[model samples]
Target chain A: MSFSPLIVRLMETLRCLPGVGPKSAQRMAMHLLERDREGALALAETLQAAMEGVGRCKRCRTLTETELCAICSSHTRDQRLLCVVETPADVLAIEQAGSYRGYYFVLMGHLSPIDGIGPNDIGAPELLRLLDEIEAEEVILATNPTVEGEATAHYLADQVRRRGLKVSRIAHGVPLGGELEYVDGGTLAHAFAGRREVTA
Target chain B: MSFSPLIVRLMETLRCLPGVGPKSAQRMAMHLLERDREGALALAETLQAAMEGVGRCKRCRTLTETELCAICSSHTRDQRLLCVVETPADVLAIEQAGSYRGYYFVLMGHLSPIDGIGPNDIGAPELLRLLDEIEAEEVILATNPTVEGEATAHYLADQVRRRGLKVSRIAHGVPLGGELEYVDGGTLAHAFAGRREVTA
Candidate 1:
């Protein structure tokens, strides 16, 4: 009635990807099998290598093959400014934005009490210890704009303040090129509350 | 300036999938490396097993680990009615529809002169030989509703007719749930020309 066992298994496994459902999984499986077997093989090898070799960076907790991730290990990056983010994807996003020469600390997740995630679980304690050990003068809270992200950022700010370090949250405002009419109420309110003088 | 070499390589390799652009490929790579490492390992193993083991079924040219695909080897399926199609995805689509019970002959492609595809490339000679060797009573041309598909169907129909075999094309018409207003003119004309009398 359906595909052979291996084909069915492959399709099911492909659904593990983010935003992929059954139909998309089927399409991807067929495409890999039909057009790019060599690419599929290479992907499989890369996945294996990444899984078996990659682990959390000792300093920042981001994924890397070595003890420290590329960002954490680089000597040229500014160690005085630390950007705290919720996941590796956020690190990549900030990197792609073509700004920010500071170092990063990947929390890997935010505080979700319902999901049993606490400070220690997301490496918050390790982050505190690393902040104490490092010469970081400022910490930037760059978690996503969500309830849990806000909670995590507040918690981190309190902890960093206790350690006598300057803590600043990333500015919440309308995105660049965004029209005020289309901006959500929460963002509009934040923009109004955090208004700065037009010194320029 | 970017992700580590391994991460970069993984992201590049993931772009081989259809519809997966650079951003999506990066997302997939980060997801595999960060959250679901175990799932990624399993996917890698599965991909390897599938690529190294799965091959075309000798009888119908559909993908299978064995000499014959499930449909080709199954005795319960009606071998008398053969459905010809382009690609294994078409076979899966028809199977999901749950109406067809006949066996299939997967051509893997349509005849496209512009791209240099010919009858031999689609295994038409093998199909003709199989038709002669089997007890097939009717052949169904189920290629897509494209110009190349129509040409391939006409060619196959002529070949089958020369062997004194009956051939019928899958009907072209407005889909069962589609509105006539949205239906294209070519399909509307085909529906009108292929009109049948209602006996009721």
Candidate 2:
């Protein structure tokens, strides 16, 4: 016999999560039912609030409940140095690195022609508008190193240069603390090609 | 900078599920916000309903939205042969095998003295009462083969035997279709000790 209808429904609904499968769904359902009913209810409330209330920041397009995300509204950040990235998660990653003082423009995705995602779909026009409005001096393209990311970066770089603004793509090479022996061939070649002369 | 307050709260709440960690929680939150708001809302509603509606079946203690679980209420099931299991997931496993026709008594957990879990915590007394009420001719101990599970099975077996009912434990040996070379030493020993004679 199958589980109770509600239990079955809960398990099925749980599969919407990225990595959860049938077994993991079942285990999560059972765990919630058995041990953490309060936490389950709290999670439900939080999920509902987030889905309905969280909206993109009007300026940067990162997720926020307010009209402007905290980064876009802050006066202390270097607004003239805007970093464009693929997703809001990338914004978080750079912030956690704790070095960058610039504001961000979240593309939310890259241009994927095979999937019919074009400039408008990734808010390229909005980004151009923001660049003109903010008159940023330097724009850093921090999209991932994938082919689509590179293509998107190049497209945005051309647009920024046409507006007479400096545009630079993030470096791609062997990662810091990564050993050369285990580095992939493509990355090793890129590292060699982009090698900088040592300056003391 | 951290994520939006609601996004941060959602990620923290998502960690209540089994096997989810900080990184997975963040990914789930971003995925739901970015791609699947409908699924996130549906999952929230289902989680709320399940947490509030599902309760233990009065007869067998398995999770159910009603007073009795489907197995406990079914007339076709062999009420005279009862299977005792440590958790509702165990009951699901046996039912999926599609061979056992007996009804089940779910303990929800096994006896673990070090964790301060005793007979009452696992509903051992309720199981004994069920045995008296059902007058089952045979009781199957389907608890896992772990030390605590074995102790619980022996304890329950003694109680059933005192009531003059036949009690048997499920077999422990090399699993069906498992290679002998890959089987562990404990299982190999158990298989050899429990070997049956050929009757051809």
Candidate 3:
């Protein structure tokens, strides 16, 4: 008749995920009890482990087991080519591509002054301070293609330029194999404006 | 960079959730490591507990911690009246209504000979035996409005009739306040078929 408070709390906690509502949470909870018991346990254990010990990498602000992340600890990674991103999820997305061997700087958020988010909120101030600490010759702004993403990229570019460092923003617009007719006008324009000649 | 097999395996395991893909699985895995460690551990504990001990009640076949379900065990419930359903989730739905005080008989599934499931697959035989043991006075069939649900209800009605017991199926068709003109053909037919005699 009654679920233990702990069970209800776990279901409530799961609702924090994107697109999950009460019905989905209930289904997920029932599923955990019915089918994926081991997986549920593993998730719980992982959460516990991360919450108690995990913290942001002091250098790049990526979620890490230690103060410094694996990228920062590794000597083989291309430290001179630093890729900056909005969140940890963004870092994972870039990593999935498996082409960029550069180290990373995770901002965790972006500048949104209207929503009360500022440079400090997204760790921009801290990132600027880290630039002097790390000898990265080039920085890539790999923020999303949204207006907020563009503004943040431009702001970062200006700050890095003032610091006398080379700053480049990741190309945004129409994707490869995309039809111009189907593409959003804004993205197409950005793509054309940022177009570069193909190199052999 | 390549993730350790343990990490990848955990991510794969977590991806079994309905909407969780590989990327969401990775984020969730990472989240488990970053936050709510104790809660995660508690979830694992509950999973193990449910997996180890929870099972169907001998009476209604609904999930229970004991041989008898909570609904069956409750002395306050109307034992003389029984509600038949296709799944335990249906039982939960009725319970949440707070109007249905009768005991339940969960079919667990409906007849699907093509999928290899039959009458016995969903504890129909067990239900048959339990009906005699309980000596219930009235049985209300509350299966879904689907073809399988209807077929299952008919099968139950036939089985109960042979024993000379009172059995009735729940009404099918358009929802409350639904426009007849807007209703689907199948629903309209069912609504017509289940229509009760009106006194003029």
Candidate 4:
């Protein structure tokens, strides 16, 4: 009786993604039916699979299908060179660069005082535990250049300095107010390769 | 174990909507969770319910929960004045304008020649059959101003004239290249009320 029950149900489910509104949801539903039903279905499957399968690595908070992330579990990666980021999306952004063989540690969020989100809310304690567990020679701050991201980086740098481990920040290839995802992969790779040590 | 599976899936669906891209989808998905999860959920439920419930009216191509659409079956509506449109969404847009008290006949699509769509493909035959079923003084063409929409209207008008029925086109209040859905409700309502008869 229904023209498109599965398609409609899928659109309803997709309305849960961050920026989608009702009108947008309707257009998306129509597009799914009209143009790219396969891609829509793929996206749906990815969502369900990611929801069911993807989890944070126990060691570094990177997205993983298992106990540890692929980067963290890989023996080929440099355990000594650890990069820190604000989210899993940022981790993916970095991975696209494809030059750095260093592992990453995701903060999962940044410190935002106005929003009442602090280090405790973003797994800073767990980060410290991760740092202690790994034999890292240098920790790179790959958080964004936003105010909250900067504060998170500063806070993280101070913590690692107290632990007597060498700390570094990613070079300023990223704009002050820009997001990591929007940046070109080559620029991000170059920034990673040209990171500067933060000794104080 | 997951913080937001529904939200992630919904964002994916939002991507298929008209204006939403990846970044916007992310923002929308986050907004739903952060600002109003219940409202978002209500919207989702409505989408599912409407998808499952709404069907083509047997009498008109307008969407209905029953065999006959509300306009077709309603005793209060003017049966003598029937309006024709291209899609179910167009029907909703016209209804929201609050001017037309007449019945509707939705074609579900316009005639697209290059894409191989024709009069028979988009329910034109069904509409021709409905002409005999309903006793109407005039049938107003409310299809969009697009070339394909124009062609379809012309085709329908010719068919209605052959049967010795009065056929008229909705006036050109909207821009030449504009869509009915994008026009303001008041403008569309006024246009419907002030509709003039087709000369050619």
How do the predictions measure up, each by TM-score?
0.85, 0.88, 0.72, 0.83
Model 2: how far residue B194 lies from native, Å: 9.0
lDDT of candidate 4 over A130-181, digit per residue (tens): 7888888898999998888888999999999898999988888777789886
Every model: iRMSD: 1.4, 0.6, 4.1, 7.6
* Model 1 C-alpha lDDT per residue in residues B21-41, reported as the tens digit of each score: 987887788787777989998
Please tell me which model should have the higher lDDT, number 1 or number 2: 2
TM-score of 3: 0.72
* Docking quality class, candidate 2: high
- Using lDDT as the yardstick, the better of models 1 and 3 is 1
Stretches of candidate 4 off by over 4 Å are: A1-15, A29-46, B1-15, B19-53
TM-score of chain A of each: 0.83, 0.86, 0.77, 0.83
How well does candidate 1 match the true structure in TM-score terms? 0.85
Candidate 1 residue B170 C-alpha distance from true site, Å:
1.7
The list of candidate 2 runs beyond 4 A from truth reads A174-200, B174-200
lDDT of 3 by residue, B59-172 (tens): 887766677776778899877778887766666655654556778898767788788978888777787787888868777777776677767777877887676677766555
Instruction: Name the regions of candidate 1 deviating beyond 4 angstroms.
Output: A174-200, B174-200
Q: Which candidate ranks first by TM-score, i.e. highest?
A: 2
Q: What is the lDDT of residue B199 in candidate 1?
A: 17
A-chain TM-score, model 4:
0.83
TM-score of chain A, predicted model 3, versus the true chain A, to 2 decimals:
0.77
Ranking of predictions according to DockQ: 2, 1, 3, 4
Please give the TM-score for the first chain of candidate 2.
Answer: 0.86
Docking quality of model 1: it rates as medium
